[model samples]
Target: MPLIPKSHPRAKSLLIREKLVKGFDNGLVAKEGLLAQGRGEAFDYLLGEKTTKSAKKAIRAAAAQILLAERPVISINGNIAALCPKEIVKLSKQTKAKLEVNLFYANKNRKQAIIKILKKSGAKVVLGSNISTSTKLPRIDSARRVVDKNGIFVADVVVVPLEDGDRTIALRKAGKTVITFDLNPLSRTSQTANITIVDNVTRAIDLLIYDSKKLSKKNHSSLRKIVDDFDNKKNLSENILEIRKNLTRGAKIA
Candidate 1:
């Protein structure tokens, strides 16, 4: 597809859809991922497709958590693997975190497809197919209930971009620090996560990678301080306020 001019009415939205279509063709995106993207797109549109200040703070905190963890694992799902394969791989390597695949709609073919995509993106290890070593996450009835023993199950911290709500709650209950990129601040995933980044996944992941690298040289105490200082509720409140303010301003104009 040729690049759409920035002046086009729906340039950004079209481009995002284009990427998803390509991902579907590559088998990296599930059929349901398209619907998930639609839901996310609506939220993104509400945010004006812009990363707010609160979202950046959440990203920074998320980075600190990943860096401070003894074992950090980056959990990738169909949407994320299709959307930010290279950046996700980069983050895993940069933070020395394990790259793992966890799917909502589990299937051998889709799982393998995500793994192939990650490997092609330079990921050496993508851990999803170890049902023999599956560990249960409590209170989740979805496919997310199962995770790899060496991956998310044992990690001190997990970066789960575009996560489902129940799994977010379950991981937290399991004592793993959870970081999520969710555009909707009100969603259970965002409110329950230790660090909720209310931003587009593409933008949020890159920012997180940048922050992780910059914070990598800092001492452990400093990284821990950053994490400790973060308040997920306050950050999410700020995001909601911004959304409300924008909506109010639009209403006044109308």
Candidate 2:
């Protein structure tokens, strides 16, 4: 990977790309994960590559939801492992959420590689590697359905960053509050999740951790109120409007 200068217009985005490429080379990210990153990058560009006000609201709600959950699990995949492993570990510690390595492109080698990254990043016990203890999530055929019984299988709230649509819907049907990070506000994962942070995961994840810690000082009733006041559909609509505004602003400049 080449050194990205701070003066580069797309320095942060370029750095993220380089990280994913390095991850693929290191066997931490799959080939498909590279394609997924490109798709997300397009949406991030539309979002002005920054966290919006609506995204901050959604992040607060997601933090409240996670804090209020009886069992909260942060699901990990190749992209997430490659992008924000340390932040995820810190979040797990802050919110007492369990870290589980769940992947759409599941395989033994990839699973071990993700687990190793998480462990190195300070995650003590990563789940989703034990086949014997794993159980199927109903109504999903993807390899992501295989969840550890102690982790996502029993979680009341799940934070699935860069998640798939099918698993989000399936998790909702199973009566879990799903919080997801998806840059595409129009994606199924965005629409179906209980709280959708329509921001780049790399940017929004640290905010989630900060919010979780701040909200921790509040009582359960306060946390519940925050979650109750949020509406995912409405927030997504606001995000779409924001995108339109960004495009309009850019058009004027051009």
Candidate 3:
């Protein structure tokens, strides 16, 4: 096989892997995060590393849901912190949502590193810094349990980028409207979320910020309808079909 040039689509996926590796070395991402990135890259490659129409609709619906919430929060993990800190800041500002760090493999050093990164990204009110004042999120026994009282604990809606399945389920059981950005549409995080943006976080965050502003002027009823009409199973099937189409085309070309 010939070498993939830096400009190639496969090379872009490799660059994403490099970012995750560097993030882990910098103590901003967990070891498991590297494996997660590899999994996401497989889906990204199959999708041609581009967002689809179904994903666009889901992204807009997620933005609408965030705008309609009384108290919205944007949850950040180590991977998201390393990948899209500035985008997260912009999305939080645009949607008036709280920014909170929620790591699965929690440690003081890693948490502080992510907090510092977000603060430098112009985030003024990043929460979850004080784990001492945490409220129990039922069904979650991991470090994801220790959310701040004024953040995820009280949020009516939350956007979880690079989310884990258990935390997503716990948040829903707590009565919060969950929105997730996961490349794997079949993942539990995607299935459990009220609105799933089946796209890369690097792409989804920026689009969400833009779409939220565009949809902000919409009335409450309109936004509610957007949420109500969302069908996760249908959306997942759409993504699966797209993947199959790409595979079939590649086979024919070969």
TM for every model, in the order presented, reads 0.96, 0.98, 0.93
For model 1, how does the per-residue alpha-carbon lDDT over 14-124 read when each residue is reduced to its tens digit? Answer: 887888888888887888889989998888877878889998888888888888889999999888887889999999999999988898988888899999989999999
Which one wins by lDDT: 1 or 3? 1
In model 1, the Cα lDDT at residue 32 comes to 86
Worst ten-residue run, lDDT, model 2?
101-110
Q: Rank candidates by TM-score, best first.
A: 2, 1, 3
Give the per-residue lDDT of model 3 (tens digit) for 1-254. 23448777467566667777777888999999988988988898888789999899899888889999999999988999888899889888988999988888989899899999999999997888885767778888988998999999999998898899999999999998999998988899988988888898887778888989999999999988987898878888899899999999999999
- Which sections of candidate 2 miss by over 4 Å? none
On lDDT, the stronger of 1 and 2 is: 2
How well does candidate 3 match the true structure, expressed as C-alpha RMSD?
Answer: 2.8
Clashing pairs in 3: none
Best by TM-score: 2
Query: CA lDDT of each candidate?
Result: 0.88, 0.93, 0.87
TM-score winner, 2 or 3: 2
Winner on lDDT between 2 and 3 is 2
